[model samples]
Target: MASSSSNNTHGKNLRNAVVALLAPLPSIFFYLSFLRHYSAAAEAGSLSPLWTWCYHHPLLLANTLFFLNVNVLFWLIGVLQSSHWMIDLYWTMIPLLLIHYFSTHPLAQCNSWRSRLVILLTWVWSIRLTHSYFRREKWQWGAREDWRFSDMHQQYGQKWWWISFFAVYLAQQVFLMGICLPLYVVHSKDKQLNIWDLLASLVCLTGVTIAYFADTQLHNFVTRNERLKKLGQDLVPNLDEGLWQYSRHPNYFGEQLWWWGLVIFAWNLGCGWCFVGALVNSLCLAYVTILVEERMLKQQYRAEAYKNYRKRTSVWIPWFKTSLTGKEKET
Candidate 1:
């Protein structure tokens, strides 16, 4: 029994390591657009057509990389992390990956510099987020379900587990593919850089900064609030004490900005499908983030004080001059 458990754990560790190692490979191919007008320089006498095709069609490597780096690798994240919620993380990535494949032809888009830059930035973000999330969580694998999900399961009852699992899993897979459409298309196109790409990269950076700050602030708030609550004081404000003053979800705002920035980048590259596809992705993320995160915050607070904040704060869009839509002040 001991030997079997040890072997399992060792195998899991190997899998997670492999996943991490392969993390950045697929996006590389997706952004570079290696296949448009590809030709075999060598004479037919020297090399077979099949060999030449594979030689020039480097994106096939990316296709292989996807299965190795993403799809199959995520299973390892689940197995090694000991929490099925790791699977949730994996599910989240599916939408991003699929979005890339669907919105843009990986080999085609990478030809364009603007589109390629978008892919680079997107890949960087993914790698950073995935690594951070994996590292932060306890890796005991199956030891504990995420508390929020656990609570949800209890509320829903056992019958909902399978349904919930697949629902979220499938949704995330679809989402992953949808949002990443820009990079794939642009990279495959072999387009050039333009004004829009510059503007979009800035937008992406701004969104990332805002989202990072909001997330950090919220995490700190939760930690401090828990400590304060133990001593029995009125609940510490978790909402908009800082950037939250203007927007209910600073993080969501940033998140939306990032995707739109990608869209704009794709637009500069002259790819219609990628640009429009990224637009759809931006809309969905905004909707889901607001629904899931905003609702959770409101439910948790549920107070007259919170009502005041809600009334004053914009759900997402920042009010440039003032808060509360310039409506009457509430105490």
Candidate 2:
């Protein structure tokens, strides 16, 4: 019976793997069709109405099409596999793709030092975050979905099929676009690199490094704990060393800092409105994501170790100590 169950699991994974490989073809074909139509219109003096509309509102059209493609992909994959975590793979990737698209546009003046700097920093940050997700989530062609999404599957039952489309995929699409507004602002202007750009770069680099270390430490700890569990030994509920000791969510803090650094870059270029994206992103991280994650950890562990860590460590800021009463105290 165990062997039969293992074979069934392997068959399901193989099917998912095949679906994942083929799913992106439609999106790619749509993009290519657009490019072909646009090129033909450029050669001729007249364009089809659809192409004309796309040309007039390139960014809006492109982003909308991308979002549609993502939603379709996720919906189909989710329905087939009864899982929504496939969308998580693209969460960090879409921003980088958008920035690359804008930065490489003819009107973007990609040659400017400022544009190059933003592109470079964004690429570094995106690649690091994506790699971290790949490692931590084991997000290969056919991997287990995240536990959170699995729980949602159980909670929502049949309704989760459609709900995942909006709640999981579309919601993330909106957040991704909003958080990446600074990339648009940076690419829109042909500004020279300034002192503020240097400072922003430093801040972004520091945040990326901090996030990298935090994830590394956490991953190592989890690996060790799993090994100990296999040996029937007790496992640690939470990590309290290195950056984890300073902040309950150091990786999250680093992520916010990185986005804020991008905001600083745009603000220095006089794009005050772009700050809205950064502000909203930070608020969501603080009030929504961190809160949900911590609540889950608290429930799952229900141990004094995690509770004490929560009491002493700042939730979203590193080195800002918290009192037992849950009030912030300057360290």
Candidate 3:
């Protein structure tokens, strides 16, 4: 009876804490995209037009400020996730301090509506994810960096995340401009929507849908199972039902695909190497997902059932399904 009461109390506390964290973070999720002054279309590789024009332009100061502040914001996100305040302070300030070293990069300019639009899109995505991170997780800092962050840190360390913060920002801003480059550079301004545009739109929508459902299902499973356990019921035998069939991580798969959708939109725009950024980014993310996710499952769920599931299902592609007999659908 006492144990059951304690579990109920824990669940209630977690629910309340998550709700408190979520209420304030969703509004600024979309604000970052709207702040940029240039479009992705103006990228000139040798600092010809893209870098020269924006850096000299006084109107783009906000864009510079935005880039600098994003690092700080990411640090704040780290704070909210960390259980300890001191660790939060250390992680948060390190990235923020590193920004000074790279704030003077040539690509840090603002120019067109397309650039602005892409910034808006990225901000919306980032903030949305930050919200999800705080609400979806239970422990504070040091519990585990988000596995994506953790693996990179373990593999690389603070210096890399530092280099990563600025290098990644410059590159993303560059890529953001590239994706929107066609919109800005092309004299025609083909904003009227084409097949690739439609596909990109659909891909993003599909991702949102999958993320929503996957999150819901996982949350329900945890809630229901926790409740059952508290009531002296047995643990669930398997989670091989909904999004668990094709791959263990439906949400991560959707996330990887969704970014590719952005790349496709960039491709249709006639941007050259910019699409390469998206492609490479997607591929790298897939590798991260596979490594970190498997590491986590290995730590938390070293069950025979999971071992069996791992044997047959493909990682990201839904090409195969695993049966209890260890056979997959015939290719």
- What is the C-alpha lDDT profile of model 3 across 1-331, one tens digit per residue? 9999878767755654564344323322322232232333334224335434544552243245434544444445443543122222222222222222123223443234444444444444454454455455543323334444444555665465455455334444444433333322222233444566667667766775676566667777777878988999876744666876766777676665556666666566665444665566566657766675566466443455566667766666655675555243221
Best by TM-score: 2
- C-alpha TM-scores of all predictions: 0.64, 0.86, 0.55
Q: On residues 134-211, what C-alpha lDDT tens digit does candidate 2 reach at each position?
A: 788555544677666777778988888888877777777677778788888887766667789889999999899999
Off by more than 4 A, model 2: 1-18, 106-111, 289-302, 320-331
Q: For candidate 2, which ten residues in a row score worst on lDDT? A: 322-331
* lDDT value for model 1: 0.58
lDDT to native, each model: 0.58, 0.76, 0.49
Mark the regions of model 3 whose C-alpha exceeds 4 Å error after superposition. 1-67, 72-131, 138-191, 228-234, 323-331
Quote model 1's TM-score. Answer: 0.64
Best-to-worst order by TM-score is 2, 1, 3
